[model samples]
Target: MQCSSYWFCPDVWTAVILLILCRFRGCVSHLKINKYYTIKSEMAKDFPTRAENYAQWYNDLVIKADMAENSAVRGCMVIKPYGYAIWEKMQAALDKMFKDTGHVNAYFPIFIPKSFFSKEASHVEGFAKECAVVTHYRLKNDPDGKGVVVDENAKLEEELIVRPTSETIIWDTYRNWIQSYRDLPLLINQWANVVRWEMRTRLFLRTAEFLWQEGHTAHATAEEAIAETEQMLNVYADFAENFMAVPVLKGVKSPNERFAGAVETYCIEALMQDGKALQAGTSHFLGQNFAKAFDVQFLSKENKLEYVWATSWGVSTRLMGALIMAHSDDHGLVLPPKLAPTQVVIIPIYKTNEQLAAITEKVDIIVKNLKAKGITVKYDDRDTYKPGWKFNEYEFKGVPVRLAIGPRDLENGTVEVSRRDTLEKSSFQIADIETKIEHLLQSIQDNLFQKAVDFRENMTTKADTWEEFVDLLDNKGGFILAHWDGTPETEQEIKEKTKATIRLIPLDARPEEGRCILTGKPSSRRVVFARAY
Candidate 1:
């Protein structure tokens, strides 16, 4: 019974009969194998190469993957269903974290009275250029009858400015509530949209209208407010590192970059693929500036009246931009498993409706088990798209895991699993596939974070001399650690010469004795400088 080959076997009839039986049983698997190879060949040509043009590749992937698109309004974008779903995942995770940390959510008005802007001189100066004014309350028919025009009679006694930030309005309301120190720490967070009339904009990075959560807190002492500010900054850094899988540098902003009217600003800065820095989130210590402006005085334990100390912190849709640039590749977005909208997508591969139905039955069981474990699974059983097309679509959309179940797989008690991060395929026994996938998702999250951390370390460099700084900025382009003269004038001169600004004075930077890289003046510690978004 030693058969050498099917074509040249001494027991040719026996071999032929065995082959025929195998073909009849495994025909679906053979067909799918062929289809998978064909799909891989076509996927190579679908996206722009990152080395060729990173910006174009990013723009193409955002739209092709159904993430977002420019809206009809001049500097805004409409987040599509897929993009919004990912954002919702982010919101859910962060919301839970906020609640666990003793914070409460509240709503605030979108419009601030025009007079409120003038109350805080420094805050107004910082945001004056970007404020959008609403002059009238209603519109009336034009005399020419072509279109409606602003009605002069409908003008309000005072105009309103669409809120660029909630500090002024929140502090005004807080004045009435803070008569006594029992209301010492007012921990309120509002998830709302704000408007700023930007001259230039990008989708999530800078838009006229954007969604965000702003936390405004009122405290009785300056120390308490500062503690709250630092606490929120740490929370943002943790979320960015653990959930978004993006490593960040925690630091305090320079005076030039501090939030208007705030005494100090704490921020988390992240590096992008193109050697640029992005401010992922910010927390500001207002130090009673807004409280004094709005007359928010609290009676202290010593029976003395004092202005309340304050802090305001926020992270917006801009985080969406940071997430996209930090881990994505030329192939498309590579989302962290913790933040992927659909953690698993099951695609059935079959030639006919009957085959698909059989495969779907097996997939349904897996989906149910995964859902029970809190994993989001999407069973793509659409007849309009082929299995190959569906695979590519989910890959572009950054689904963390993809499972393929066909008739052959059903018979073999196995399933094909593909990871979006590495684009590698493997087969797992169906006996405990759900548990295996849960472990795989965790591994994917850790792997993405490690990869980003490695990239950041590679990109970060230290420069001791002006020549080295110039070369790094011109060619290497990432975060450059260098000593500064500790003057805003020196910082500006460096920016004018090299277009690289001091991103931050890193909170952990050790004091070192060295001359300034630009001015040769005695320096205390190095600051992070980079071309940033």
Candidate 2:
């Protein structure tokens, strides 16, 4: 029952007071802005400035937009269709990759026995607070006929907990499946739901229930497990950069931030427009924790029982939040071509059935060709809405490329193509439409990744002193790259004061000579630190 009930408004006092005045005066100055966009956001203070209020901006975006809503239940969200569509696109892409990587999809029970969670001490402890346990099944009506509740007689001997992660339960079953070394490398990935109760919930960012894929691999040795972790991490990084068009910092989580019961945790971190960090994905090298806990052993060459090494990695619906903030603009979302459900959409503008019929006929031909090439194409022929309104709707939904065909195009043999990312429009001959649109989609994807990378490069700052570090975090805080002295105390101290933490120790951050900004202890290299999702 413990869940994040509400979020205290973290906006500045001046901004809050201004919104009050503007509400009555109809003046945006009260909201600290010059004018209003519509009504609510007009004076809402340009995303609260990442340096001044990073967390607030994230909250504002989630609630202001119709992406998602906080549920009546704590820590959970009611994802709107628009938001769910984005996640569906992400799932389609990642699922295809998993299948291509020699992995089989499977499902596991949502409720795990409470004792099953305790099999791995660290894992259980880490997730205990967030777990939702089921104690009773059936409830009987009271004599007063008020409300029916759980029936005590129907209770089971072992209580069930909503799974926070599936490692323990998955491994417990694997023991029965693995009889020899032939079943050593078990490649299985499951697209499922997980619950992790949070003290605070923000739409897709940290909801109690999220949809994700958990890839579990049972390897014969530690080396194989490590290899699998790195491989999947790379796969995630590649997909994020190319398919989702998001630039990410692939890195290893520090011991404190690492996944519970994992030897090493690899992750991909993306910087949002708010200059805060979001962990887009994580891969863990779980040496032998689950294997030993579940007694999953194999007979080696010498006939001795040897523990199996395992790896589990995942990326969740939270990536939808990251994607929205990373590339989306004031208008709405901007989807990359690969992840977009429709690579191209044809909106025919017309005044009559003759014109409409002509447009639909030609659009049908174009769609046929696009489909022939295995491209996803959508044709909007709804007449109830005006072409302009439809344009705005599709733009908000982030269709990668929009193709417009008017009656004039029929005579001229040309169509207008617009890219959602850049909002750039171009005219093309009808014959060249297919090839050009394909090229434009690829170009848009590349441009988005490049833009994200450029932002990350520019926002990353290096601080040599504690004052400088704190100042940067207070002012331009994105990713503060610096030496950590590699201690937990310093990490805690920084987070307490600034609400920022070591997001990750990047995989590519080269060794450098420096002193810890907080501890003044000797250090070798810089790690990425930021306020994170």
Q: Of the candidates shown, which would achieve the greatest TM-score relative to the real structure?
A: 1
Per-residue alpha-carbon lDDT of model 1 for 369-450, expressed as tens digits? 9999999999988889988888878887788899999888888999999998888999999988889999999999999899
In model 1, which regions exceed 4 Å deviation?
A: 1-46
Against the true structure, whose lDDT is highest?
1
TM-score (C-alpha) between model 2 and the true structure? 0.87
Instruction: Give TM-scores for every candidate, taking all chains together and pairing residue i with residue i.
Output: 0.91, 0.87
| RMSD over all Cα atoms, model 2 | 9.0
Report per-prediction Cα RMSD to one decimal: 17.9, 9.0
Residues 1-533 of candidate 2: C-alpha lDDT, one tens digit per residue: 11122332222210110001111111111111111111222323354433334355456556555568888877688887767766787888788888888889999998888898888999977777677677765445544555443456666688788788999889999999886787778999999999876565667877779888999999888888898899999899988988878888989998878899998999999987767788999999999999988899988767778889999999998888888777766555678888776778889999999999998888998998888877899999998898888777777677889999999998898898888887788889999577777788788988888888888887789988888987877677578998888988888887777777889998887889899988889989999998776
**Model 2 spans > 4 angstroms off:** 1-72
Candidate 2 has its poorest 10 consecutive residues by lDDT at 14-23
How high is the CA lDDT of each candidate model? 0.83, 0.79
